[model samples]
Target chain A: MTTQASVAPLDRAPAPETPFFFPSGDRPLYAVHHAPVAGRANAPVVVHCHSLGVEQVTCYRAEVLCARAAAAAGFPVLRYHARGHGDSAGDFADATLARLIEDALAAAREALRRSGATHVIWLGVRFGALVAASALPLGPPAAGLALWEPVQSPRDYFRAQLRGLLYSQVAEGRKPTETVDDLFARLDRDGAVDVHGYYLHRALADSVRDVTLARRLETWNGPTFLAQIEQRRSLAPAHAALAEALAARGAKVETMRVPEEPGWHMVANPAWTSPELVAATAEWLRAVA
Target chain B: MPWRESAADLDRARAERPIVVPSAFGGLVGIYTPAAPDVPSAGLCAVLLTRPRSHRNRMWVEGARRLAAQGFACFRFDYHGTGDSEGPTGPLDPNRPYRDDIVTVLRVLRAQLGGRRFVLCGACFDARTALSAFADEADAIAGLMFMAAPVVELDTLVRVDADRKDWGHLARSLRNPYNWKSLASAGRWRYMATVIGRVARRSLGAAPAGDPPLGAAFVEHFQALLRSRARALFLYGRDDAEYESFRIAERTAFAKLTPEQRARLEVEVWDGTVHGFLEMKRQRETFERALGWIAALHPARAAAPARTIPGDATPSAVAG
Candidate 1:
């Protein structure tokens, strides 16, 4: 007699991920929805908010893997490009912090409607985490927040970006004609500065310099998962401080120190996958679901 | 006039839609940007190949939009296992040209967009793939644009320590006292040693094993394409190593081409532009030059009306 397991396929194939466009204001935002395997009841959908500029391109594969893992674990996932980025309809110069937050809110609503879930989870990486947190107050209710190597301080982050611009300029064999102050001045005079290919608009630059995660998520009391991704075994000091602040606000915060290089910003092998990061995130999603 | 008037005009002119083409590996996701309604169509569709280690969003997105604005219907897609496409990503091998995916996309373009003539555009690894695919679909292709295409297979194996063209810049930096401080770091010392060791090994005739010379088949295919009715444009940055390799590796093959064949090909090297053309100034120049070249290919079709394809009427709109 054939056993039940032997007679049938060992596992059912996962549902195919879909690509579509949704309207955010007048422009369209591109998104890919990874459907969960059938037979789950009342699972929360996970909406991804991607990083800006080149980091978004570098972190793309890692995000895709994590989303698939979460979907396999019964969480419907939506990965999208914000306005002025990716396949989305807009120019980079048109993007602003306010516009990015608006797009995030739109994505959260779309995820809820598409998945037919009562609540959703915001999964953001780097600058995307800040966008999600800033949009928290003005959104449909979310069940949880999951961030991978979130940017705790926007001022420092933009400063580092400006430093990157300088590094690229040097690598191109150009003598440093402009200092950091000159770049700021250019942003003020021209209303934008070209960092690599993406133009950093004055409005977006000013907003990023003025905002921080602590200020944005001050009153948010909800379940949160923070992944501090680094090569070291210990959690970063900034991540530790952010976790403490969240816990003090009566939020159930679970922080994990992932001993892996931050593939989100580095030039790594194309086929590289962060297994530990995916497993930890899947476990967290299962617990929260 | 309002400052946003140009942007509004662009929005009104062009329309973008997402599409998925069924492939043997899986469904390949892509975005199609149609030519502006007001501008006359060139009756040509552009198929852009994806660069390795990066999705279509990096440079291809802007490149596609710019092409659309110039009255060419453009389609950019992810490979089977990349971007939003479905499949398990395999190891990164430069030699593994995704020729099957390119051919499949070309077939889908003919079916969905209703265009018989096409242009293939790619940079770096994708550029190499475009050349390989042109060998298979030369009859259907009208033009090709390759940015920094690597002609020598050995260039991928041997690591060139520094671009020889940047010697002036290096000497200038060495003369500066402030730049000398960087030499104090251990990392800088280690890098200097590595470069010296590599140079010494090369001088001693100690070449790396398994380094293959430029293949004769590759040269024959390129020469045949040049001999065809299709036009080709090659853009490269002066400082890029690929430019040097292409010059050295293809010198003999290029010399053998007939004058008429050479007339169909154009090669340009832009100053201060690196391999990726990261700066906006260089990128704009590249786009303008490419658009001009493609438009000159079929001047008679410039005033032709844009054809209405099935994609325009019924886009593959999946519920989200």
Candidate 2:
């Protein structure tokens, strides 16, 4: 047994990535700061916004992989659990798009201060990407933004989540006593509805559904990198359409379509990592830097 | 305790540094330790929260903090391969019967914080691991909390899954005739045929027996645990059918236990909740119940009791 008394209490070596909890409100947000190695002393720090619920659970390993790769490529990174998510304070049911944006802004400022980086770049995946876009105003003198398979519409995403919940209930031989309309009504009446295991509040649903990234992408004039993952041969039409729209807005956009299974959904396999995705991301950050 | 780091120091360091738990397996495992209590109390009790098989330590992070706020020391760690722990990725093996990781963590807690009375809490499959680990040293644990622990018969589980899927198919077809209409198409029929075949294979006689039944050993451990008079809490979701299957298995196992042994067990089922206590309100209630039980089992004259249970707030204190 490795007891504290038995093992020599040698101090841990200074790691490039320093983990800490930063203030948000009543509960502090859990965050990790990946300091750039010696060579990139003045590198731009990237703040990572994680995906929601099950996606966050499964893609954690991938997120770690991506952070390490980014750090190796000389980008100091700050990845945090937003309020009501991960190690952060507050209940998941109380989460709102506004609160998430506020939390992201706080994380970016903390990262910039701690890493001594001049600029903040928001790197987000899935719903996290949408948050990054919405939080753009909070991070001033933005270096760039990276969006990975960002959710096109919050309403559509929530609907899909509801379908999964229904399918599971049915698969388990129990009929979900509530329908989609019933859930919306419950959210309106009770201010919250339990979907799967997450508590979805009316305020959160209403605010998130109003978020349209296609309309907001032009607001971010900084260099942008958008990567989409696809299971089949061709890129998803929605992703292509997004890339075209960003380009039309006169934004410097670099789009890449990596053919691979969605890592966020594969929770069983913890070691699942998309080498191509990580490589493409690192390369894009290098080009932009 | 003079040789160990204080909780306040740990907290200060945590705010500025990454905290890693040293593993017996030659590498550091990632851990989220709640800030140690400001004033160290005598006979300080600590809780070690383990993951649900595939999940990392994040599931128990919030609960750990709640326990810490209540003046108990808490540690949430990723087992060797999962989370940020240093090890090759793979499922935790319950059969191998070795838990050097858990022992190492306990030893660290005892040595560092003077935490003598420890509570081992596990969710789902991890409950079995915690139980097995505590069985060897029953004298050490103050309590054991099992959340959605699976002690179900394999055949029962398979049947339940098939029945549920069948009901789902029927309900959908009834609700939307288009579902039945789609079955008229060749592709839909083939899909339906595949589903039927799969279900048939999983049935008791047709399916290949994979894992050996936990059988008498599962009950034996509990009996031994209760003989030692350690408190045990079984919290499951009322809506979970799989847990119902586990309850059936438990009934058979508990039939042999003495009433005295059964008296040590406490079970709580949250109505309208899912398997993992996914909703925040339910999670809070579950934590509150756990706090109440922990307080009652090892009541501290100095500490304040948790919030009162309004009517059904109290967990059913059933005799085994």
Candidate 3:
């Protein structure tokens, strides 16, 4: 048996990634910083806001790959878990959309401070894109925005999530005893509903339901990259409209439709990657930088 | 006692530290939650493994926190090529455990945590990995907590896939005369024929070729675990197909165990629980049961009382 006082030293050198906890109010948000590769400086630091629930798990690998790619291309990248998510301190049941936005802004500031960069770019995947966009007018000025399959309508997203809960119930061989309306009622009565292991809180549900990205995002005209990740070739109508709206407000908008699996929900491959998505985003980052 | 601390102090009690341990692939990213200082340390560390497709956050982050609160230092990490860990991702075989990555984590824990016996916990594919790791590092492991582990390797996956693809649809279709006609189509007929053939072979007391009895390796590892000093708790949802398969396959082996080995092993099948325990209610039940089992392992060292989840009755014990 080993003694409590004897600590063994690490045999290997430190990895390029640095994981730490930064404060978001009294609670701490977990974050990992990937330093820009050798001698690169003054490039806009990238702060990543991840999606909520299972989508976060599904897109985790892709997010890591994208962050590493950006870091290799001379941009310092910071990937963080919003409060009440991942290793962060808080219960998922208490997490609100507003709180998530606050966490994103905090991450952006921390990334800029750590990298000593003049500005920051927000990179968000799925619902995270909505968060990044939501934080735009509320924060430290962003140099650019990169959204991968952003959720344009929160109401539709919540409905889909509720449908997913029902689907899971049926998939587990249990006859779903409640309808979508009944679930909403339960959410109202209990203030939260379990949606495939994640707690969908009423506050979050209400806030998300009220958000219409195109109408709500009225300020800040920065360079933006919109990636429509799906099997089909065309940009989603809602996304195309959001891109047009951003352009209308003097933001330089570039949209790419990557023909790939929408990894935010269901993924067939565990090590799934979208090289095209990464490559295009990197190019966009370089251009904006 | 640490459990009597103020809300603020209790909130500050748990500190999640992120660590990167070097592996063959590169670095494996993990979060380590040390046992609360105010609590009596069990001198044991729990290593939580991630399911193949899911990240560590699935149900593990909260689990680690809960364990840490109960005086067990806990670590949960992403396997190389998954989550934030660096490596080239490739197709993973369900039968093949990620032994190398698991061993790497174990070594790091032994080095960093020091002087602590480890409890290996995992679910589904990861449960198999934990069992394999326990068999390989028996001396270092004090206990094993497995949820819905496959007694017969790859069998659960096959059943889950079949359930998703055919069983439900087939059962529903069989009730309708019109659907029976559609089921007689070439593709459907081929699938049904294969199933019937397998059933016929089983009835004739002939095992399928290439399908070893009770998964030879799993049985070997399990027997090794039983012979060791380490204790184990196996929890399964009654509805999970693996539950029935495990009960049928491991019956003889479990029956032949010595009283001492049986005393150290436990098996529980809960009512209305699914394979993943995806619902919060079921997850809480699992965590409470697991925590209770862990606490019972070393009662003198346990710092807090095992929390009882409401509405969870006594689980039906299949063994021990």
Candidate 4:
């Protein structure tokens, strides 16, 4: 079943939830394409890939809202889970670089087939950014890229995430019931590494460690934009350094600053959203990608 | 004092070749060092040590002192563009001759530390870049010591590779609800900002292009790094979630190494270390293991060529 996507044309209905089954003959990817109930066909496509962890569940509402906004803007938006999350087919343990890459390629193929649009605009949050960066380059390139807190270094990220978890839990007077090693070992044994209660698979974690999108971007040689927000300025030094490095290589960058709630990483607090960052990325993409 | 002992503290020491054996890569090799420039003689060695690896002010002699006291010279020198070296000072820009820096760092280490009996050591991702230097010349190194080497095979290592996703926007949105659309349009100077961001990524990206591996280290190379030499030591926190993220498979791989290969391998699991090995008392254990390594090498040192080994020679003169 070498199902390379060749989507059938359909009229864009207002607020339609288009059910899609994307198969690469390897794994079937389930997706729900969103469009305004009364939109015209050939609308701009927003391929929204979600984050990993409990946030994937918590922030799902926000993703829906973003998709709705894009749909209302005479643009069709689509969001899909990587093999293991939401209603996707495979187990999270199956999340590997190769599989995710295949899933991303299939998603892009389906996006092109459904929208009648030739180019795509990738909207990735967290791990999704890596997928889009890796997959988009395998084809005719994307129009633009909008990434939100894409995992920068899986090692540092997981470390920060774990430290954040410990701090928050400790602040709340939580005791270390089990050694952190046990938790990681449990994850490895079970194939799903748990981060702040979100169970992620071994393969997915491997994919994260293996996928280097900054290098991937260097290869893309197309319109690219990385929106970095300075909340507590935690990422300022690192991302700023990264920004400078990227700039020298020739990629559009938009940096935005906003107040941070210190414990955003500690606990998944959905209270902060930098409007400036969102605007900067949107505008950057409009101009470049 | 032959070299005007610049490191005021290491004025008294001597050089010793603790071990000389056939390198795993089919080459003859051994750890060598100079007698302490300042002290000149004192088998105690710790009080009279003098080899510094970085360009200058960026001296990484601390790792050696801390580890050597327990008994081995762990070379934590900074290569080009890092630490004290005048090479690449900017943000790991990736484009600025990193390979040259890699070559220079190793070449300098070889010139300075190889003849004096020193083991090559790396911390975190530094191991990856350092190993890449020897990827072609693995046979020349006396031995490799990776203190807290990242598990490049784990998925977490790839985060740096994802590029500048609008994390700021995500952070902003998570912090508060602010309409991001009209803002960029209203601001007349956005294009320049966008252009700058793009350029920075491109520049950083370019550095890693010729780099053997970018962002994350894979299982294959990581294993090679483990087996690159017969005397390879990997120290990491087994319990640290973040460290364990990628190390999960690597730890497993470490066990699969042969006994002879494994003899060359030492895996020290810090009960509770962050990615940086920030545990309270693990430093003591780490130092002890290093001392044990030095002791183990004593037998090998007896088998190597004997010279009128001056107890005063520091690591600098003998290493070269």
Candidate 5:
């Protein structure tokens, strides 16, 4: 005389994250992949692209949280450091735009091979989104692309970084011996300029400054998800325009306006969590799956 | 000639042996061994880099790789709660007893590399950790290389607080006609006067060097190391005024030591660099310098069997 509830199935626990290294070129890229806990139909292998420099460090915890969420939601997740960044075997001073794109493509292929998902999805933030966009033509066809606060123009991004360098100098009460023009001149003359700690080399800088995502994504008609941060209720006007443009390109587009505090800027705090963004992204990914 | 050249160089030397050691608190420690060819004949000192408190061991990877490439075996590891290491954050404290973690890593590293000579390298709060760990196990280790270490007096700290590099920008801004026009306002004039007085007071050493909370006696710790004939390197950036304060305090401490003890310590400053040596060129330079210093301090005793021991050598010769 056994009760009906006595033999109920136990809830499946999420897979423990595994850290390993796989090669893109001669260099090994440090990667952490989380296998899906429960089997789901038509699941996409999610590959995360991290932003560069300090952002990469600060955003790591958030990335881990999101990756765990995706894994828990029954999606196989892969997050990796780009060439010359993080635990990867390369020098950051030598990283170029083309190289980053190639790395993204390599990562996608590897993720697909490892996860055996029906299709691949690219989830990236800041400069990482640009890498994902540029790799589209080279990589396996993506099932979906999710960009969080993607930079519209590389030139604008570079300019903003320069402004930040200037601001740091000014705040220190030290007059920069070289002006912005002088720095550009040095880059032209010597093929690189030391801005703060980063070396803005000729090849990387030229390629980055010339990248216009709007132009590159014009014909890319995939399922696109754009998450923009907003302090108030309405969507940012620029993000709305980008969404409209993508939708016009024959892709099913979804927009989510997350809270201003997205929790990816503090390296010291390992407990920082972005609940709204994580919930939104997980829900959207699950529905699509 | 191409951007890929550097990457190629790094890749060639990028062999890392990733190992996880069990810690005391039922947790695992993540350690990465640099891809260095082991030369047991050279008796090269192995370096154990401590984590810089909040920073997750990523900052020291480049330095470790560079050292390994130059013949020294380098190991970088995360403490209990940081990086990929497993542990609850509750039990991990930088100020409290963490010497067990350091000793465990060293013991495991010694077993793996089969090297007796060891050097502890750390920066910032990590420097404090290295110093404390060395103090506890001075008999086991050879030397230390500390960067931007906290070893400052109240006066030096105040002086560092007053120093600034904004004079060039300030002069240019003041000369601008637009600024003059704006300065006509009473509020602007008052603000300018306040700033000017503050800067002037700071520069003139009028600020009080009030008693502030001090950590462990850093000078005393170094003196102990020096007395034992253990070599030390204190590195700082010129732009980091706080480390400059440390430089001044450390020099004052050195004045009280005998020549033999003084000879065991070396202080270096890198110009046009920040505390972390964040710039690529400077970072490389720092690594090279550390390698050179290590070579000088702990030369292959096997190579020159009859050579005079560093401890027994003339103080002037050691300093030179």
Candidate 6:
């Protein structure tokens, strides 16, 4: 039989509000597909990618804002639940860049078919940004992407996710091994992160670890937005640095720092949550769409 | 490894039945009972309900609906540091800080009633909490009902005695950082109690009297609790897998009592019903049935004809 020998480009179709399901790991991938309620539907289709963990819930505020912004600006948006996410089925440990890309492609193709949106765009936050960068199809007739807090270094993102759970375990005074990598293989074998309940697997962890969004990014992808939050703590120098690189390669790069608010990664502080970020992204998508 | 979202499951869960239970330390940090009875009676006002480790609150609403149909206002609240009320799920505060709130609520209910015979009812451990804290000198609380009384069952880990699937959470929760550290000495009575509670649930059953001493009890001593203050009624469902065993074991041990011990005890069962009678629709119907059982125990105290009217009232209508 045929293995994963070649990339099968996705053929996705969209309906008024029907969720497009992509074949992901022996199950259909389902997502809530929202189109512009008001006008002709031939708008840019933006595949909105979501963040990881609790932040995923937190990011719903942003996703809704962005979708409305796009829909208002005549863009039909398709949001797909990645495998092991939402209605999509598969073990969480099986969540790799490959499935994520498959999920995005499936969603994007569906949006194109359903709305006749000629251009596809990628909009993401945090881990969503990293995945979008890692898996955005490489070719001509491509979609532009706008990312917020792309963990510039894969090492740092891995550290945050793994450490947040394991450290909580250790903080509870339970014995934890020296580092998360030590438990990664063991936990992956268990198909669970043991502490955090996130799916863990060798392949998925490797895909996440290997993604250095800055190095992987290039020009020709067209108008890129590298949104940052500044306070003395800039998450990754690589993010700003990548913007500079894309600009150097003749791609239009815009660096906008949300100066007054705390980073989305840290939400324990109630005041740090900025509804303004939601407002701005919505406005930005409206203008672009 | 990357974590995937449980979006569809959450959607289904939300659509089917939405419920929120904070962790031991979740929610607003306060325990509140219903306000003082001075507030104008709205003919069965809604009362905020809470109690310690309250799976029994499931039956409280069942009881509330019975009284509500007759236009009575009552509320059951969680203990200061227990259940859905707030501040730490367990590690039950020995000082019982929440007792003040319970006292305050009862006083308010007393003041509000203006001698209208306000009633207070509790299921499981809440009944014990009510009896200990707010049992006297009230125009309200004309009647007290304790369903599936907590005294006998509280002796065992709920995991062993109740239909609580949430026992897994308790078992995991008891592994709380504070509990683990306290048990380091391994010989302390406090440590023993903690260990016993956890191990009791983990073990299939058969916890001994000396097993870590969380107010350990003898079979003979437990029966003395049959004495009721305000014509107490004990109602349970026969179909409930958990209470069926609990009822059988309790009634057997209770039956062995002397005539004096048997006099104050009155028990009734709803055949083919689960703990809380969750399988039945129309919770009021289940409650009215229970009320009929309770009313039968005190023919003189009865307010209504002990009759249930079908198609006359819905749950929402009763909530008002």
* Chain A TM-score of prediction number 2: 0.86
Which regions in candidate 4 have their CA more than 4 angstroms from the true location?
Answer: A1-19, A24-27, A36-44, A177-193, A233-235, A261-281, B1-320
Q: Candidate 6 lDDT, tens digit per residue, A1-289?
A: 0011121111111223343355544556655456665664445677777765434534443464455445655567777667655434454556677677766666667667766777877877777887677556541144577887666775676666677666565544567665877766665566544333233455666776656776667534467776775553553567767877888887766556665533333322111233445445545554454
Docking class of 3: acceptable
- What's the true lDDT of residue B53 in model 6? 19
Instruction: Return the top candidate by TM-score.
Output: 3
- Return the lDDT, model 4, position B185: 58
What TM-score results for chain B in every one of the models?
Answer: 0.72, 0.68, 0.77, 0.49, 0.65, 0.44
lDDT of each: 0.70, 0.63, 0.72, 0.46, 0.63, 0.47
Identify the runs in model 3 with alpha carbons over 4 angstroms from their true place: A1-15, A168-177, A259-272, B1-14, B51-58, B155-169, B173-212, B301-320
Question: Candidate 2's error at A81, in angstroms?
Answer: 1.4
TM-score of each: 0.84, 0.74, 0.85, 0.41, 0.74, 0.45
Summarize candidate 1's per-residue lDDT along B168-232 as a digit string, tens digits.
54566566654566688886766555555555665577755432355554575676586567777
The DockQ leader among the candidates is: 1
lDDT of 1 at A74: 84
What candidate 1 gets wrong by more than 4 Å, as runs, is A1-13, A168-177, A260-273, B1-14, B51-59, B90-94, B154-212, B215-217, B220-224, B298-320
What's the TM for model 5?
Answer: 0.74
**Candidate 4 residue lDDT tens string, A4-64:** 2222112122365554456654455556677544444544577876665444543343454
Best by lDDT: 3
Q: Report the lDDT of model 3 for residue B117.
A: 86
Residue-wise lDDT of candidate 2 within B146-214, one digit each (tens)?
777656444444544344355356456557644665676796676566556545665545654443344
Better TM-score candidate (1, 3): 3
Q: Candidate 1: how close is chain B to the reference, as a TM-score?
A: 0.72
Q: State the lDDT of candidate 3 residue by residue for B226-249, as single tens digits.
A: 767998888887667666556754
DockQ of 1: 0.31
Backbone clashes counted, model 4: 103
Q: Model 4, B1-320: lDDT tens per residue?
A: 00112232121111322121222211111122333343322222211111112101111232233334334433332232221122212333211213344444345445655433334444454544544544544555555545555544322333322333344533443343222332455442353245345446665665533222222333545555555653655555544433443344443664466656656655545554524322213433443444444334433344523322123321111110
